[model samples]
Target: MNPRALRAAGPAILLVAATLTVFAALAYGGAADPLATGDPGPFVRWGLPVAKLVVNLSAAVMVGSLVLALFALRAGEKEFDAALDVASIGAAVFTVSAGTVGFLTFLEAFNPQLSAGPEFGAQLGSFLTSVELGRTWLITTIAAAVVTILAFAIRSWTASLFTAILAIVSVIPMATQGHSGDLASHDATVTALSLHVVGAAAWLGGLVLLVVLRPVLTDRALPAVLARYSSIALVSFVVVTLSGFARTLSSIGAWDQLGTPYGGILAIKVAALVSMGLLGAWYRQRLIGRVATAARAARSFWTLIAVELGFMGIASGAAAALARTSPPFTETPYSTTPAEILTEEPLPPELTLDRWLTSWNVDLLWAFVAGFGIFFYVAAVVRLRRRGDRWPVYRTVFWVLGMLLLVWVTSGPINAYQEYLFSVHMLGHMLLTMAIPLLLVPGAPITLALRAIAKRDDGSRGGREWIMWAVHSPFARVVTHPLVAAAIFVGSLWVFYYTDLFRWSMYDHLGHVWMVTHFLLSGFLFVMSMIGIDPVPYRMPYPGRLVTLIAAAAIHAFFGVSLMMQSGLMMAEWFGAMGRTWGPTPLEDQYIGAGIAWSIGEIPTLITAITVAIQWSRSDERQQKRADRHADRTDDAELHAYNARLARIAERDAAGR
Candidate 1:
């Protein structure tokens, strides 16, 4: 083998050997018991060892192949490209084989009653029959694993093809699983299982790819690659979160079950995920470019990646265990009573306007509609005109509606939930901190407003003056400043959540409304300040933008961790009333909620930071070049003018002589 191949094979070999050793111990240690119990007979007994071997061997091969591919990215490694191709193909094959074998083995283990006899289908008819369901889960998992592996093995076109296929195949199984579907359906268990499998695969697979390939990529390519990968990771993270929430709600049945064993495990899992995400954010924002620049101690980047991978492993293990265990309180003969259960919910046939409509659902609906309208209108206006103009009536209406809708949504939800209030405050936090900001940042309302004012009839004397003044106003510049916006956005989340203000805000509707409004506004200002979706009143330099992102991310990290460490509920009475149970104890539930805040919350925020940083850097570079060219032209003009003056002076002197 070539040097690169040998180096790549070392890690792969070690990983394979380690996995094999582990599996061997697991298989032999318990193989006889399952066979003796008749829960699994000779078929499973025989299949288990073979399946274990295949899974370990294939994993090694896949890792090895990925390592080899990394070699192709190194400078002066043309020969390595050929080797990479071979390894990639080998990896793809082995990954597929492992998935297949594992699936079959899982089937055998979970569905030992399957017989070659005519009554096979009848025997496996019960959808909830633990054995058959386990087998199906294994099959789906292997399928997802195969597709995810293949997605990274091929060229761009082929990779995209495989990715799309993987997404479709993976989502079908997920939807079929209980978590994504009706909780009361027969497939609920399957849905939950499928989601866990797919979510874990997507997250773990992407991390593995990044860790293995990152070291070899060139500097110029690293940022762009990171940007692309970050986008994918963001999408995956969101899916994982959404799916997890759905599964938790479905499995636990009621909020009070959070105090149970299953709930505790789920909370731990959430914390682990959040920690991993924070680490990922750190790597992307702090270490990524440093690694590319070959800064000293760059190996730290690799170490962090490994740490991330380890956390992912823990989470996966926890998930595997959770799947095997029954949910707490659920196994009891009597179900826990829900605090409030809406019956026969009605849908509105026609839209109605009400000034006193303070319902959470109503606010959320209006916010959704208004947010969409504002974004659409603003985008349209920008596309229509190259130069900035005044805010149009349509745009104005949309902005007002969107902002009002947001205010209503944030306030109403907190108010409604405050009655049961434990973490309803956190829900308020989420709306203010995450959802509202996301909607508003992209809308670029301020920029649109300024543009609209500028578009007024030139003949109107007062209109022109107002437009120019607003555009040039000190208030506009200061408020829209990147630093100022980021501070408010990041600071508000941390301060409100950490202090009595968070609790105090929940007591009354208006207080809650004020808090929510502030949060949404702060988030909007912050995101818009950092990212130039619509024109800002004033643009910060690239370095400033980077600093803003970094500082804000740091603050967010602190917020999450602080919340995770809190000993008591921020809003106890409301939470108790809402039937929001963390696990078995208030503290545990708080920890879990904190974990959710700390970990899952960081994923999107970090992604946004990285995106803004890269965009700003690229834009800054382009702008600098333009400035240089302009400066050169000015210099040339001055030189030409001087030469002309000198010539005239000489001609006059000669004429006088």
Candidate 2:
């Protein structure tokens, strides 16, 4: 097919393919089978998935177009505007589809009579307001509507970026409903499904972007833009692949279960993904460079893009069906104990020396963050080395160590038991706020990034541009300021533990994410203000640094001591109620956690004070060396001039006497 025709037909092909596949899969899986009681009819059954398919496709285009506009296309240009226009249109569709899905879901779930009567309206309103599933879809619909307006109104870089983030977030509620896996797999499933959805959006949407905007992709610009898009697609593919694996593991109980209806749909999706990945990584990748100069390669690449779109349609359709299909079994055994009832997870084996080293429950989000963190850092170092620009070996080591430690803190024993064990939670907090920052600050990641990443001459802002903007942005200046950083660092420790923030973090996933981010960023900023090599707006003298550290440490110690002195358990309903036959009693564990905060936390402060002193000494020695060098170069002209002025004044005074 001609490129123009193919581009126009891409969405149609995907829609038709998805439509065909979803009903067939639904039939085979018995998801659309008649209910034994309170059946909402076939229209409700069929319309929901169709609406969801549109939501998935439209979400992809909206988010993908915005992301591609940021990374791949130049700003203030036709192609860039076109991308935003595409996103706006996609968001509009997403809003409508999501709203339809929400409404249809209500009908399917509640079997409310389709009517405009007050009674029917009241029932629908209660469902939308009172039910979790209803609320999730409602929020998704409203978020999509907001994204629609933002995407239409915003063309500037920052606005478009924020709009893109909102678009991504809008799909999260739907992704959360991806699998009905065990509660044991809740965090992992949620994280993985969210990533898979977002990544697949970018990958599929970028291709749609290329086809739909073919007129603007000039020969000279096409190669570079395609190359950039390819890079984004590659990263997306990796994320999708990994996250899909995690979701799959949670869904399929055993190898034998792969023959089940859910498994059949999963297998089809997997095949589509693998095929798409190969096409993207191999054929399309090779053709992107040649497409500018070679006409045959251009045609071949566009054809391959069409093929990938079909595969995406298959994957998207399969995914929607799989979400509705019942899995073979679940990992959540029936929980009877209070600990299990409250936490939605079984009580881990009693906290012990061996478990700290051995226990693991992977949090995919942070693992991916750390994994990519290490990969890119190493790549930057290699890029510098190849260019004969040397980065310190110790910096690289510290960076890797920091990332490794981050992975462990997030996904290791600390994460597994932090919810159940107060001492473990406090230990993780101290490490996150103090020790990890100590290791990470020395890495000088910002310095390395500025040196390693090439500057973009084009109108588009790449990684370097974004980094510089963020550092110099007003928010950074305020947060990085010494007094502000110190205040937040100290204030948050008190504010978090004493306020409902602690309870929120324990109960809500979003709250937990916010808690971790707040501490890590606050810690990093405080440490950076003190000893980090990265450029900041301001820094105090060495003595002042020491004083600040001392004051913060004193407050920290006081906080710890106060916690230890508390007679009652914090969040007593939670910490006190978990029916654990484990190590220490609740009160004793709280004391142990407070002890960790007081003693172990103070060690990092001591280390920082020592580091400051050593840095001060080294700075002074370097100043003296510079002074001696100046003396050797110019016979101490500055010193001689000062002395001569003093002598002249004395002689004049004597003459006057």
Candidate 3:
């Protein structure tokens, strides 16, 4: 191999070897055991996890490279091309490894022989076509294959973005596969696993991309690229850490269980993760600035990166083993009630004021999002201040408050009882769509980000660049248009509840995520169109803004009134089926929800309208002040013209008389 290529490939090869060795040892010693009765032999037992390891690593490469490419690397550059090539290779490996896992899984479950018999072929066909698990793997394999081709072919920013998304989606099937025996809380487990896998991949893959691209990058460009990547890595680390903890908690309950083999492996993973985090912090704090300029520092940085890869390998390996490790909570196999069979959580205690405040189901996804959102925002503000830039304190406060409220709504009582109580669901909905955005929009986070983040002048893009692109893009302009925003805001209320979308959110975890995202976005757009301080493609005139607000409020109120007038319960099968003995009947709860929609929901809309009016008044005052300034500059030319016209009319009238 050539010297430069060898240098780039060596670290990754060693890292993979280290990961596989550690993973296989852990899997064999701690968790992996061939099924005693329907044994699929050592091949299936060992091959599955190794396959999974390949899947994980490949996914990281595919996702991380695409993300880094989109965010940091410039198109038509050698570094960008190298990243895409790595992504394509990763996708190819992902495709093959995923298919192998599917085959191994089929062997493990059905113990099918390799004979060319018709019955065997039919059984295989049924497994691939009829079974959900088999279908999942099949789809994932196919998607990976597609991504492989696309990653090789596409190099543009938008295409790479889509490729990244496709790579992330390919892992979802794997996320849904693990811990399947626990049917009741499968949603939580699935959500946690999905987040964990995605986060870990991005974290691992981005670092690997940096290592691979070291040769291609120039000394001048490396630090800025690293800086951009550091943000993504930081966010990825937060997500992984939080999701891993949540997944572990769901499996291992008591503190004493930490002594078990499963817990030992988990501890090892945690230690490795902590070590990597510290290493990352050291890099950011000490080495990130100097690596680009100082020769000795650059060498030290590469050495540190190699060590960090070692730690990442350990973590990744242990994670694979831990998936195979049987949890203590699942060991006892205690009898479960029907509710436990259905919901995966025990029926929550009676809802009370105190319970509403204190209860926690721990939706780690949203919780971490909130936590990181607050942290990064505060960090950005602090960064600005340290550099002698001024940022409004109120924006920070509003953002923090909004995020805290989001956490409460997602992880607290509203989340706990939303499935059982329509009123609580509506309350959460209102908060997500109205109250949260009310605060968040006024916070003007996009503005803060634009101001606080440094502008990237190189061919590459960073957070500030992306944020600017998003705000000014054709899609953004279309969506953020006052009319479009208002239509979406008012239209969602009817479409969400009156259709199957509400029920889908109730039953499906992914659907629930979509619901939250949709509402949050719609609300943000609407609020931004009204009184947002951030720059947009276009905003309506102040009177038009007020008019939009009034129209949206009226439509929103009418939606609530329509709900209040409903004769029957919405999603009776899902919400009504949750057997709750404590609170209102399903119909009465629906009525309460309608009331919340009609009365409480309008409070924010009213506040928004009032805010719009105040903004309108201030806008007019600003216009008048601008006119005065113009008059001062031009010696009142408009007034002089008016006077001339008046004099001419008076002269004409006098002559006629």
Best-fitting candidate, scored by lDDT: 2
Q: Would you list the rank order by lDDT, best first?
A: 2, 3, 1
Predicted candidate 2 versus true structure: per-residue lDDT over 388-458, tens digit per residue: 98999999899899999999999999999998889999999999999999999999999989998889887
Predictions in order: lDDT: 0.52, 0.88, 0.83
* lDDT of predicted model 3: 0.83
**Residue-level lDDT tens digits of model 1 in 463-537:** 233445555668768877887887777777767766877666644323454675677667777777766476557
What's model 3's lDDT at 584? Answer: 85
Give me the runs in candidate 2 sitting further than 4 Å from their true place.
181-183, 331-334
What TM-score would each prediction reach against the true structure? 0.41, 0.98, 0.93
- Output the better candidate (2/3) by TM-score: 2
Q: In candidate 3, what are the lDDT values of residues 1-657, reduced to their tens digit?
A: 332554666556646755675566555555457566888888778778878877888888888888888888998898998999999998999999989888888888899877889988898878888998789889999999999999999888778888888998998878887664453356677888889899888888888888888777888888988987887888788888888877887788889998888778788889988998998898888988998778778777777777787888888778777767777677323436544544556678789989977887667778878887998899899998999989889999999999999999988889888877889989999999999999999788888888888887787778887787778789998999999999999999999988989878877778988998899889988998888888889989888988888888788889888988889778777666667788888899898999899899989988988998888788789999999999999999999999999999999999999
What TM-score would candidate 2 get against the native? 0.98
Clashing pairs in 2: none
Candidate 1 regions exceeding 4 Å error are 1-38, 41-168, 178-202, 253-259, 329-657
Instruction: Output the worst ten-in-a-row residue range by lDDT, candidate 2.
Output: 176-185
**C-alpha lDDT of candidate 2 relative to the true structure:** 0.88
Residue 405 lDDT (model 1): 48
